[model samples]
Target: MELRVGTLNLASGRDGGGRSVDAAGLRAALADVDADVLAVQEVDVGQPRSHGVDQPAEVAAALGASDWRFAAAVTGTPDPFRSWTPVDPPVLRASWETLTGPHYGIALVSRLPVRRWSVLPLGAGRAKLPLQAPDPRTGETRWWWFPDEPRLAIAAELEHATVVSTHLSFAPHTALRQLTRLRRWCARLPGPVVLAGDLNLVGPVPARVFGAPRLVSEPSYPAPGPRVQFDHLLGRVAASRPEVRRLTIGDHRLVTVSVHPG
Candidate 1:
């Protein structure tokens, strides 16, 4: 079977005007990727900012996936950083309030059954450098935003393979440490692995440090006319080569890939 994987920005819930994310536009964008499993970035679980839409669940329902899981990079309330927290998961008839209830950071959506799951934390502290993009005030170069904690890596074990997704820090040094943590995690897995998300590497750091291939040749941030490649899909393919794509719809782009089993 041809397994499709997708990584989308989801605009972190709105456009420049701070409007709600377009549900129809989001559904259309998801349909365009049509991946078997999807890795989403900037998803708003229970924020009023997103108009009470549990982004991952809504998208999964729209796509009719048999299974889905979310790992929140940030939560709606204060920060303590626990191993796991309980919240009402999203469902078909789940209300906007229910749908938009508190959510885990990052997430994994799949058509196949997920046998197991775990969340890995990458420690903080590293240099963040802003990129030069087309913006009015800054006119180009902007400072990179570093989260309180390093980026997260969420993994799931399935009947056939293991897949992971995370948003890497924009800081080069921080990103390198994050990738190193990811490598250590990958070393302990017992099956084929596919890692995807916003890599934030514009240069050769990905190849040099991660030992994974860049699925596409384009930038994922700055929406319209992206000049830097921040998102990525990578991993070991066993006896097969990974198939990755950089999909652009309107002002957003998604990076998706598939790893064939040996």
Candidate 2:
């Protein structure tokens, strides 16, 4: 069976007119790539940033997927910003307690038949160390250190193989820790496996550091600019070189991997 995967960073709901408004470019981008299984990051379920649109569901529907699942990395409290960023229309906005604040999360949608689904939420926080590396060619400091919640990976038992998707932490150290943890998780799974998401390592690390064979990495972030591949897709099954494509939808660019198992 062929497995097609995609990853996108849906800008926060704060920018979307507080409702489900078709993001002009985004809608077209999705139509262009037409992935069978999509893993999206920075999707908001209930926030004005995305105009309170259920981004995951909307995208799934747009892509003609029959099933979809979402896992929140950060579940906003009902009044998280009440004491912090209070609004001017306090009394009016207070009437609807549930309609306040944006809830950020990640999601996986698929057209392939799924037998089971599971999620692992990587803790949210900053890296403990400062990673400072200078570009060899430009002699410029590439600040690779930044704190972000631990990545959340999704696992699914597909009809022919197991599929996994995750967004890695920004900090190199955090990503290292996450990679080690991912290896452990992969060891326990049975049968051929397909792993995809923002692995955060752009260049030669996929085969060197991770030690996985038959892997493909593609640039999927900061669309239409200097390409720095932050997204990736890997598989355990031996096969031909997987095809990689970049999809820029809305304001985010997604990477899609098409893999063939041996």
Best by lDDT: 1
**Candidate 2 clash figure, as a count:** 10
Which residues of candidate 2, in runs, are more than 4 Å off?
13-28, 77-101, 128-147, 238-252
Q: Give the Å error, residue 137, model 1.
A: 23
**For every model shown, what is its TM-score relative to the native structure?**
0.74, 0.73
Off by over 4 Å in 1: 15-18, 22-25, 77-104, 126-150, 238-252
Error of 1 at 52 (Å): 1.3
Lowest summed lDDT across 10 adjacent residues in model 1 is found at 132-141
- TM-score of decoy 1: 0.74
* Residue-level lDDT tens digits of model 2 in 1-262: 6667666665442122212244443455466656778777766665543445556666776687766676666545232222222121211111012333445556778887678777765554454435443322232345543336435777767777777777777677777678777767866765476666776666657545555653555455555562666666666665443454434333335556666654
Tens digit per residue, CA lDDT, model 1, 106-186: 666777777877777775553433432222111232333333433577776777778787777767778877888897897
Residue 22, candidate 2: C-alpha displacement in angstroms: 3.7
Assess candidate 2 and give its TM-score to the true structure: 0.73
